[model samples]
Target: MDHQGVPSDALDPASPDPAQWPVGRLLSSAARRVERDWNAHLATWDLNHASHAVLAHLLRSPMSQRELATASSVTEQTMSRVLTRMERSGYVTRAPHDDDRRRHVITITDAGRSAFFVASDRELAASMVTRGLTPEQAEQLRRLLVVVAGERGPEDDPDLSAGSAG
Candidate 1:
């Protein structure tokens, strides 16, 4: 293994030869690839993964930049940059909070929701990670990933407890 703990033979990040890597490395590599592919898929819509998340969250509810960063799992600095671009693109609008002049609330525009759905449709069709998995296998994979990420399952959420499809 190299100093970075990557197998010397697997130095090529573009290669799909993770057969010999350790479990952690394999998982990380797979995640990186998935993120890259997802970003590429969103490129046509002039959106990146971070921006997409921000837009989606704003679509759900208006939020401050700090709230968006936390919800999007990004740093406030990163969210600020993303918001700037989004505002410039007219995908969102930032307005001073009525009660809090120091805080700015973000709202998704109609165009943002339209773009989000369009990109979402294409994303579902182009996602390569689940290409050949059966429904059961996909669910298993999702559960395992959720565990690895240390996140609660939908079953744990009160809103999802009413016999909603998993």
Candidate 2:
């Protein structure tokens, strides 16, 4: 089948012909598109999608660097660098942990929150790329993506239940 054409169920994992799998390719292409749109949307703010993600995670509540790393799915070193840049930009503040002075709790500043709101709006607008799909089709796509990622949506993130900034 052509890349623009709908794939058949025979190409699914249930089929024996693993070589014909198109799911991976489709997802990769979609991810690239998302990244491209994200970068373009964030360019106005002089920030990248990764920085926006980190800020979004912090908007929920202050977290240790380690927690931010896990929540952002970024390495600790990467998180540190992002935090340093954010701090220098006056977007975030680091307060010494009450229990452990050696560890600092990172919190989003007013500027950070404002920037986050802008970034969130940009992201929502970019998601309109799927507006052409019907509601049911959107749900089906989401379900299929969830299945492929082997995740249970927000249910998989315990922090989601805590009602943090996000």
Candidate 3:
């Protein structure tokens, strides 16, 4: 309600609890909360979200910085910083491509694979987001959030990304 005793969707910045926030604010803050909690969990393995992402990609196959940046939907400059950090942590290595010395391929090290295996625990991650919800409720929440996010990329629809033979 506003000063005039009318309903309002606007958020009160002074509020300490998110339950008092607007829907949009609630959603955005909740996402940040989940990310923060997840990062804290990943810290045990000495890996954060961005570094873990690079490791996951390298686990499949070594890729040039350009390829990784594209796959991760980030810029080469950003990917370079991430690679540098991961390299110093002994999670990944960057070496010049044989065919093209201008391009450096990034590969996950043994330590990276081990950390990824442990840090990428599905149940642990899921619980961070779905805690207190029943399995069915969590599944419903997942579907609702996806729908509310509106846009769907090719990966969201397997039939579209992977052609189905008629």
Go through the candidates in order and give the C-alpha RMSD of each one to the true structure: 7.7, 9.3, 7.4
- Model 1 scores a TM of 0.75
Q: Which stretches of candidate 2 lie over 4 Å from their true place?
A: 1-21, 126-135, 150-166
* Predicted structure with the largest TM-score when compared to the true one: 3
Question: Candidates' lDDT values, in order?
Answer: 0.81, 0.76, 0.84
Whichever of 1 and 3 has more lDDT, that candidate is: 3
Predicted candidate 2 versus true structure: per-residue lDDT over 47-152, tens digit per residue: 7777888888887889999999999888999999989988887888999999999999999999988887877784365365466777677766665566557766
Pairwise TM-score winner, candidates 2 and 3: 3
Looking at model 3, residue 33 earns an lDDT score of 91
The 10 consecutive residues of candidate 3 with the worst lDDT sum are 157-166
TM-score of each: 0.75, 0.69, 0.78
Ranking, TM-score, top scorer first: 3, 1, 2
Best by lDDT: 3
lDDT per residue for candidate 3 within 14-86, as digits (tens), equals 5898766766788888899998999999899878888888888888999999999999989999998988888
User: What overall lDDT, based on C-alpha atoms, would model 2 receive against the true structure?
Assistant: 0.76
**Which model, 1 or 3, shows the larger TM-score?**
3
Candidate 2 to truth, TM? 0.69
Q: What total of clashing residue pairs does each candidate reach?
A: 0, 2, 0
